[model samples]
Target: MTIKSHSSRESRNPRDFNDPRNKPQERSERPERPERSEWASRRSDRPEGATRERTERSRPDWAVRTEQRRSPRERFEGGDRPRPPRGAGLLAELRELDRDLIKMIARRSRMLTRLPASGASDHERELRTSWEEHASAVSRDPKLIRQIFALLQEVEVAPADMEQPTAFNLAPMRKPVNVDLPAPASDRLPRVHMTLAASGASECVLHGVPLNNPVMECLKGLNQVGARLRWEEDGRILCQGGEPVSGYSKSILDKVVHVGDDPFNLFLILFQMVTRPARLKIIGESGLKFVDLAPLRHFLPLLGARLTSVVPGQEGLPARLESSAMLPSEVAVPADLPADAVEALLIAAAGWERPVTMALGEHPEGRSVASKMLPILRDAGIEATLTDAEGALSLHVVPGKAHFGVEPGTGINLSAAAALLALPALAGGSVKLRGAWDATGDDQTREGVRELFAAVGLDMRFSADCAAVSFGEGLGEDAELPPLKPLTDLSGLPSSLFPVGLVLALIPAVRAKGGDLPRLPQNTDMTLVESFLNQLGLSCEDGRLVSIAPASTPWASPSFPWALALSLAAFLRPNIKLVNPGIVTNHLPWYWNAYNSLPTPSLARKSAEEEAAPAPSRPARRRVLASHTPESEMPDEIVYPDED
Candidate 1:
């Protein structure tokens, strides 16, 4: 019921000035403000000033304990939505109770630090007794309160005195290994699918790791437009679907309207789907600054949405969509939409009242959200037709009522195979990846993953439902690969693979910096890669061809798995632990177990450094392989004849 804008939350002033980070910067120490090109012809058009520092770092905000109170006359409400007012009489009592409980816990915690080891048993018993007494008291004299007393009972009795927490270095986790190897792949993460619910909940139950930022923001977009979403304790994000902001109403969000800096992939299309008489203006910031939003600007207006006010080529956001009544039956989709921007568009288009034909000038890869949407859209009672003329793909959609039933799941991620093969243990061993194909028969992206493996020395094989790859003898030495091959249309591979590709390309060039990376069709978010590597003790600088490198500090931090695996396999180091490693669940939660299963390259006679060379001085090349093509026409390396 309450929408917390991640962007706004991050920008909020820290409540505690006591935090060491909030210390005022010395006048000389403050970093100089960089010159911006914010083209503000009017004062109102100028971007919010606090916006930069708010997004300077991609790290997540500290979880705010404060509950968002809904307004009495709240937007989109038909009944009383009770919200506890903060710092008032009743709520203030709850806060004081919370403080008292915390203090009690802190007191007990401090007592453990002073208690003698010989007397720790007695101290522990005393604390346990106190907790039991409190629980029994609450049971007997239960007061009608805001449930603060539950905290006291939930406290864990501490060790009178135990080991103090110490920071541990996790670099060796990725230290390159030398061993004979084989690897396995599994589809373990919860599969998330779009539900065609005409009424009731449009539930997206998370199957694997908990939702990360990008995924969270995508769902949050749905939440803002009337999808009542809440995380069930079982880890499902249950969304009561079809509650669009039909008309203008106030959101708790401060009135400076803009889609905050977070990137919402295909979810942005939901803005158009929101019940109109409502005006939605999404302003892009930071990572989205360079994205060309021409497709949205050109096409959204064709629908009953107004964007005539948006000044072209000046704003980071696409054209503002003011809901209108006129709808276009036919529209052409541009070839340049980044992967994040296209999903919501397809769903919205498919659900239109009349048959809508979308002309996709050229679809380079069949693994993007767009590719997956073709089948899902069809299953939703929309007649989806694919016609290719001289290899250009055009989709014709005939609108029909949506029906709920079983559809195919997303394809298994094979980027883990790249990391596994990059390991030195597999220099001469074989690797097989099961669960690479989707029930939807989406294999194009899986092939791209295999293609990246092929760029090294791995040979790949595919089946109706599975895939495998093997490495050659002394593979690491003979393979003089480039620093991550340019990340173009990634064909639905995990975005983390881009950085992994960079690491693997350096298999033969440990001393060399990375190569020029192609901004991908998926509009890959390097922020996560940067955050992952930054935690890994490496620094990430964004550019068309970012020369990826780490600070001069001793190489460490195993936060990012692919980044860690790349470093270990490329550099041959000890296995390390991931800082907040659980974040991997967003893209490849299962890869962690698969990573541990991989044999460490601890036995290599020669390290990646011993065989390292100068990065190849070569111009970028576009290598597009024809799908379902004859083996005779394809390169020996890229060809994979599916076994019957």
Candidate 2:
């Protein structure tokens, strides 16, 4: 210990000491510390082999200590060192391509939900403009070019937007296409006219033209029996009542001619004619229903038209009219023709029996005729049989045991005939009707028939369950009666009651025998009844159910033409009643002027004036015309001229 001590710095490792070669080193003489291994051995009591080795193993090594020397990013995050950076250009390019692809996908998704221009709503058009602007912006961006190409694979380019390519130098499309042939005219084809007689009084005309359509084939198999037809200058057929034309007339003449545009009307007219024609044939290509004609085979004979059967292969059958020596006058006209037809015949037959009584019944569901009347012959005891011929229902009234009850299958034709039978009894004759009969039901037609009788001054009475008529005397100048009242309820009565009630009512009223009775309008239907109330200034809130105040006057005379009156007489006969002359004449003076005047247009003029006035001013704004030109003010090649 007395020996001179060496400096502690000289005992330290050279790596731990300062370098004297590079710079001036400062040294201090101090006592040296013990070695770390000696200190560790002195501090621990455990065995050196196991405990010390375990402690050394638990401590971090040089590799972990070197890991603490992190690069810039790792040092900031307090983590291990990082590798050196790669090039930036490639990574930025790749990132930009991804962004472009995402934007393209978004645009395509928008385009998918958009409708085309033609079907676009207001909002859709605005969206389309915005989308186009966005697409143009994206196209100009260099960074989005790759994404645009990739998205093009997913989206379809509208054909309207694509440019049409040509192999060589091509010319622009010409305005009009060259066509060598002329356009066809509508009226060039030949035409034919077919006339069908209805009810032996009127005729329905059909025009046919040769369109050569499939429906024209129906003209085959018609009989050309007793028809006198001549073509007019205007391509119409004047079919007069005469002898039948031959079926073998000519192929061109035999084939029916087609009509103008409306083929359905022509078919209907032909159907009506063929069903009851004296003779019929296809003169040309007239459209007809072959299937509908089959069911009418039985009616041809009654119509005086004879239908001939065709051979299996033949296309059409010839039709002939049955000839009889009897003249039109000699042939008793049927009673069941449409009211107009019956009236015409009656007028012609001025010498007809004055008061012909008839019996009527309800019309069956599927019956073609509106109504029927069975005549009651005085001398003969045979009941009447009625059948529809043409538009008329022929009444074969032979005096016999009275048959006045309605059978289940009875149709309107029978009811009409029965009504005719009851007419004479109302006119001033004695008649008896058997069984109950009533016409009241849901049928508007029945109400019409009832109205016809009421208008002529019939003493008609109806109950909820029954209808009755009492012919005390007859309708004449001498007789007088009380006013008429509306009848209610006539259900559960026999169909025959309609005719019997009419007869009983008509006899007394027409004879002027005295009684109160219901009044009706000339038109003779539920509609007419309602119209009459409306004309009298009453309103109807509900359709079938009507409310009416008691009429000031007893009755009103119906305003109708003589022809209508005659039709009523023929169909309704003597059972028809007339209103008092005083009530009708009185109202005519006051109401006629209103009916004749035309409606004024003051209100309409006011509305037009209001619409023509200028609109109110608001804020001024820029007026935007539709895009028709480019930035140079010249029309763009893709710009639509008319869009502006």
Listed per model in order, the count of residue pairs whose N, CA or C atoms clash below 3 Å is 24, 85
lDDT tens per residue, model 2, 210-314: 222211322222123234444444334343534322212221223333332233323332333332222334222211211222322443344334434221211
Q: Write the per-residue lDDT of candidate 1 for residues 2-52, one digit (tens) a residue.
A: 898877675536787877677888999987754454333353374686444
Taken over the whole model, the C-alpha lDDT of each candidate is: 0.47, 0.33
**TM-score for predicted model 1 compared with the true structure:** 0.48
lDDT of 2: 0.33
Best by TM-score: 1
What residue runs in model 1 are displaced by over 4 Å at the alpha carbon? 1-192, 195-210, 228-277, 281-295, 307-314, 317-320, 362-371, 389-392, 407-410, 414-436, 440-442, 472-498, 511-551, 554-644
